[model samples]
Target: MSLMSDIIAKAKARRMRIALPEGSDERTLRAARILTDGQIAEIILLGQPDKLNAQAKTLGFTLDGIEIVEPVTSAAYETYVDEYVQLRQHKGMTRKEALEVMKDTVFFAAMMVRNGIAHGAVSGAANTTAHVMRAGIQCVGVAEGFKTVSSFFMMILPEFRGEHHVPYFFADAALVPNPDASQLADIAIATADNWKALVGTDPNVAMLSFSTKGSATHPDVDKVIEATQLIHARRPDLNVDGELQFDAAVIPSIGERKSPGSPVAGHANVLIFPDLDAGNIAYKITQRFGKAEAIGPFVQGLNRSFNDLSRGCSTEDIVNTVAVAAVISQAQA
Candidate 1:
């Protein structure tokens, strides 16, 4: 089975509760219908019940088993507001601010995850990434031992040049515009952990740079080298190598010639780019020109499961993200 199909199957088996904050969006409603019909997860949509129902009717679908919650009218609304104030009180957030923030569907959905009302939350369909991520970071918080919350794209490549197809993960593609060595290390570790959780395989991480094994020298190459060292010091068990060019990281003959006997070189399943400039451009190029199927910019390193979607995402994209969040929830639990 394809990786996404496997994820959906896993989600169905787990049957976790996932919340959608953008119930007013047509794509989200359609995705909710698909999730319910397939028994992927118990979907809780946050919005006005009447408006959501009318929208579903206009879209010619039934939200038969889906639960719709009007956030402001729900019994937990005031409680959530109070708790949010406490959570952010150190930042000088008052109940007044918390009340207004809780009215937003994204924050409400994240609060649901925070309070265990739902196992996970997915948004960003009609919201900006910054807004969705702000809600996630503020409400769900970062995982223990993680200093950075990052993202990865699961790239499914087509069989080409007589090689069989396989899935690879590209990291920090949609978040963290520019990362220093420390943050880059955190990104690598987070991506590797999530890759293993979802793919059920050991991660071979290759930290990408323009120069291979000190063939050239620059601050950019130095940053990648330092990040690689930090990853080794922190996670020695991880199979990781760094300061490798793109070809050396993926191509067997070139890898042997350049970085011989390196565990990750030539066999890397998780590619950690130096910066967002490289990662975002590379993933898009691979998707458009290489004809690879890219599934995510899946958010990682959150204590609770909260994912973001592209603003232009399709209904299938939303369904897949919800499935991913469900699997992450199960794994975290």
Candidate 2:
């Protein structure tokens, strides 16, 4: 089965908890309703209860088995406040302000996951990337071994006339603006882990650049080469190669010609760009012009599971992301 099918099957069997801070957007509401009715998991929506109820009724929707936790009533508030105070103790945060910040739906939702009230979180359809991550850092923080947060795009490409519909993974597009060698190493590690879980395949990561190997003499190309070596040194077990042009990374003939003896040369599933500008543009071009469907900008490396959504995402995006979150929660469990 495909990744989506696998996640859906897991959703049917496990009672995953998903926290949506933006609450009642049409896509979120629709996704939550579908999950609840289909026995996918328990969805905890963040916001005022009466407002959510009214909106649901107006849209001819039913809350039914879904759980709604308003900011005031959430058990996570206390937990978040404590964590926030600790994380920001050096930054001079009062307990009262910490409590107030916890009331913010995103913070509260992250706290829910931090305190085990929810399994994972999905937000950013109604908030900025930094704000969503801030809620996560100040509350749940980064994953055990991960030092910083990284992001990826779980892009889905549809088949067309004998073409294959394989999903591609691109990383650090929505976070880590310009990663240094160390940050690049972290990105490679995180992307490798996520690929194993979501795509069920070992990622042969390509550290993409405009030049392949030492064929070109540019500082930018040299940077990619350095990052690749750093990543390899840090994670010797990971199958990764760098200083590769796009064609060399994906095309077997070109890859073989460029890097004669590399495991990740010809077939790379996870593509890591050197900087955000290149990463973001490459993915967008593929998503729009290349006829690929983009699913994430999913935040990784957090202590707990917290995902973000584009404001313009569809109901299907919400559903897929929630499923991704479910997988993450299960993996963390």
Candidate 3:
């Protein structure tokens, strides 16, 4: 069976709760309907019930199995405001300011996930990446062991025969512009864990750079080498190697010739770019020119599951993202 097929099937069995804040968008409503009808999740739609119902009817969507919540009118509104004020008080947030921020759908949904009203939340369909990310970072926060939040693009590549699987992962493509050695190591660890959780494979991580095993010399190459050493020191059990070129990371023959005797060379499924510039450009180029499916920018290192969608995403994109989030929520639980 397909990877997505297996994930969706597992999600249906788990019956995870996923809150979606963009209730007025047709794509979101359509995805909620699909998830509800498929019994894939317990769908909570965040918006005014009457407005959502009207939007659904106009779009010919049935929300019979969905729960609609308007943050302004819900019973949890006051409690959520109080909680937010406390959570952000050290940053000088007043009750009034907190209340105002809570009215934003993304913040409201984040509060829901924080308070355990939902297993996870998905947004970014009707909002900017910054807004969605800020809400998740502030409210739900990163998992305990991680220092900061990061992202990964789950790249479903074209069929290639060999030892590795069809899908792969690329890290820090949408967050952490220029990570230091520590952050880079954490990003590798987090991406590796996420790949194992979502893709169900023991990740062989390739810390990518412009050089291959000291073949070239640059500060940039040194950074990757240092980060690779950090990962090895911190997570010796993880299968990872670094300072490798793209070809050396993915091409078996080239990898063998370039970085001989390394376990992760050529067989790597997780590629960690040295910086956000390289990571972002690589994933986009692969997505557009290489005809690969980039299913993320999935927010990693978070304590709870929360995913962002592309602003131009279709209804099917929303559905697939929600399904993936549901699976992650189950794993976190």
lDDT of 3 by residue, 1-333 (tens): 667777899899889999999998888999999999999899999998998998898887668979999999999999999999999989999998988998988999999998889999989889998898889989998788789789998887676654233788899999899998889998999999878877787999999999999999999999999999999998898999988999999998999999999899989999999999999999999989978888877888888998888999998888888888998888889
The 10-residue segment of model 1 with minimum total lDDT is: 157-166
- CA lDDT for candidate 1: 0.93
- The C-alpha TM-scores of every prediction are 0.96, 0.92, 0.95
Model 2 weakest 10-residue run by lDDT: 156-165
| Model 3: CA > 4 A from native | 162-165
**Using TM-score as the measure, what is the rank order of every candidate, best first?**
1, 3, 2
lDDT of 2 by residue, 108-187 (tens): 88778887888999987778877987888877778876687988987766863344677778987878888887788788
Candidate number with the higher lDDT (1 or 3): 1
Predicted model with the maximum TM-score = 1
Local accuracy by lDDT, each model: 0.93, 0.82, 0.90
Model 1 alpha-carbon drift over 4 Å, by segment: none
Rank order (by lDDT, best first)? 1, 3, 2
